[model samples]
Target chain A: MKLLELQAACAAYGQSQVLWSIDMEVEQGAAVALIGRNGVGKTTLLNAIAGVQKLTGGHLKFGGEDLTATPAHGRARAGIGFVPQGRHVFPHLTVMENLTVGLAALAGRKAVKESGIASHIFDLFPKLTQIKNRKAGLLSGGEQQQLAIGRALAGQPRLLLLDEPTEGIQPNVVQQIEAALRRIRTELGVTILIVEQYLDFAWSFAEAYHVMQRGRIIRSGSTAMESASEISHLVNI
Target chain B: MHESAFLIGQVFNGISVASLFVMAALGLALSFGLMRVINMAHGEMLMLGGYLAYLTLLVVPGPLGILVAMPVAFLGAAFLGGILELTVIHRLSTRPLDTLLATWGVSLILQQAARNLFGAIGVQVVAPTWLDHTISFSTGILSGLTLPDTRLFILLVAALILGGVALLINKTRLGLYVRAVNQDRPTAAALGVNARLVDLTVFALGTGVAGLAGVILALLGPVTPTVGQSYIVPAFLVVILGGLGSLVGTTIASLMVGLFTALIEIYVDVSVAQVLLLVFVILFIQIRPQGVIAVRSRALEG
Candidate 1:
């Protein structure tokens, strides 16, 4: 079943239009990657999906429920967890406090207790447990990225949207994140839609890929059919 | 010995005044920190609290009347603040200058309303008999230093409130949401934090604190409509000097302003001390523009 769908999605930053009538769909429990060069409205599309960027014109649906008019927080409560680019972690808050913020998404919704969600997150990222009390700002790039993803997962989102999760991190931690994403999808059965500039990581993690350029999906296919080098070459990487 | 004792007394006065400033400035600081909108009418929350305390005491008269008035004033002011947030501040949140002007207008209207309701002359809240005595010092360098129980009570109440606020911000789930929202609104919202609800809660909470300040103010003097006006400026200074709406920053800034005002008044008149206080703030800002505690964030530098 399709867990997410976007029809004629259009978004703009002020008067400069970034996303133009983009249509996309992701099946439940599928890991999909959205790849594009800089300035190709990839991040904007993710923002639109996360409900942070308002769709100037479009219809968005999650789990067959219309979500076009839903605000960001509403989208979050409706099971859309967004790990935005740059890992916008709450700097002043401690690691545990940051994770606790994810529980806030489940205010009126049925969910596991705080400890239940937290221990799951810690199991996913053991590094977080050791430095749970440390302020998020003091964390390195990789740690912050992990925290951002863990923070989103703490909400127990059915659909997770990650934008460049592997950006500016150590290779070892990047592998760790990739491994976590695989488990998050295969074991946890969470649907994943990731926007990435890293072709290698995108190819390995996502079962399907959509290439976006100038706010529209230009090409999409199963990862089994097309190689990362081909898509990388086509997009002139 | 007398001189030293007088200095000690002024220090106590500074602490008392600091406590008042903390209550007045906290709400402004929190809301401003979160929304980046200055509430020009925040002073009215204090006024409302004072008036509410006056009215509550009328019905529940006794030594515990002031205690009863505290929560009444807090809730009343908080309700008014919530209304102000919904009606005016929320509408003008994006346009900060417009919010200022609108809230300024609201402040004027509230002042007028108070004037019409209770008269411009102001009403008094007599401190209970329990607060009537003073702790006196007689021999030593601190001799002649006299501390009133009312002032001590104010100090204790302020401390408790401050502790409560601190705990709320640091330890609670709500505080976690508040911190997240303060740092990144869009991101926090994306994480399913109802930013608007947080704003309403904080705005109301801040105003409630202001109301509590008002009740305390009434103990020191008359509960006039414009009473908040006198402290509003200093409260703004405290917020400015405190950084990015951080609680620690606000508390420290309040102490600095309160102590500076009190100590300066020793050598100069109240008016001159006020000028010196402004000058001190200017100089202080020049050195550390970020305020007492700097909050580092990846977004929203302003």
Candidate 2:
């Protein structure tokens, strides 16, 4: 089943027209990679799906419900979790506090045991447990990324949107994140749509790939059939 | 009175005044820290609270009338503040200067409306019998000093409000949302926090606190239309001295302003003391541009 679908979606940043009419779809529980070069509207597309960027002319359907008019917060409550490009975490808040903030989406819904979420997140990112009490601003880049992803997962969204999650991280932490992403998809049954620059990382996780160029999807194919070098050449060109 | 007694009396007066400053400045700091906009009409919320308390006392005339008036004022001012935010502040949210000017216009319109409804002279809210007593020293060096029960009541009420607000910001779920949005609006909204709701809540809550301060201010003076104006300037100074809307910073700044005013009044005239307070604030900001508690944020403007 199609968990997410965008039809002729168009977005603009104050008349600059960043995303032209674009169509896309993601199946339930599928890991899809949106790969493109810099300034290719990948982040903008992610933002439009996350409801942060206002769609100029388009319809977004999530789980078969038309979400074009839904605001960003409404989209979040409706099982769309967004981890932005910069990993914008509340710096002054402790790691625990930041995680608790994600639980805000659960308001007006069935009560879920917070301890369950906490233990699951801690199990995935064990390093978070050791520095749970420390302020988020004091954390390293990789640690902040972990906290950002963990914070989003606390809401237990069915669909997760990540923008450049592996950007500016050590290789060891990148591997840890990749492993966690694998579990988040397999164990929790989350559907992921990640915007990635690193071809190897994206190719390793995503089953299908969409290459965006000049505000349009120029190519789409199964990841297993395509070579990373060929795709990298297309993006770099 | 002895020299020590005189000093002690002045210090007590300073603390009493400081409590009022704390009440007035808290809302200003919190909302300013979050929205980066000042509600010039915030002073009018205090006036509205004082007016609401007066109206409440008319209906519930008894020893507990003042107590009943407290909640009435809070709700009344909070409701009005919420309306103002939706109608005025929200529309001009992106333009800080426009918001300030527009709210100032609102303050004027409200002042005119009050003068038309209640009269230009203003009304008085009588203190209950329970607050009529005074603590006096009949013997020793403090023989001439007297502590009025009304001021003590104000102090107690201020302390309760401070404690309540601190708990709300630090412990509650709403508070967590508030902190999250205050730190990062776009991110919080993306995370399912209704940033608009948080803004409205804080704006209303700030006005509500001002209303509480209004009730206590009525105890100190007549509930006049311009009563809020007298304190609003000092409250702005407190917000400027307090760092990035921090409660602790605002409280400390209030104490500093209150004590400085009271202590310097012993040496200079009231008008001169006001000038000195402004100078002190200017100097303080020159030394610490980020206010008392520096907030580390990723937002370039913040």
Q: Candidate 2: what's its TM-score on chain B?
A: 0.96
Q: RMSDs, each prediction?
A: 1.9, 1.9
The residue pairs found clashing in candidate 2 are none
- Residue range B69-112, candidate 1, lDDT tens digits: 99999999999999999999998877998998999999999999
Among all windows of 10 consecutive residues in model 1 chain A, the one with the lowest summed lDDT is A110-119
lDDT of 1 at B93: 78
Model 1 has a clash total of: 0
Top-DockQ structure, candidate number: 1
Where does model 2 exceed 4 Å of error?
A110-118, B297-302
Please write out the lDDT profile of model 1 over residues A159-206, one tens digit for every residue: 999999989889999989999999899888999999877888788888
Candidate 2 chain B lowest-lDDT run of ten: B293-302
lDDT of all predictions, in order shown?
Answer: 0.91, 0.90
Q: What is the lDDT of residue A234 in candidate 1?
A: 54
lDDT of 2 by residue, A105-188 (tens): 666545454443557899999999999999898888899999999999988888999999989989999899999999999998
Residue B127 lDDT, candidate 1, scale 0-100? 90
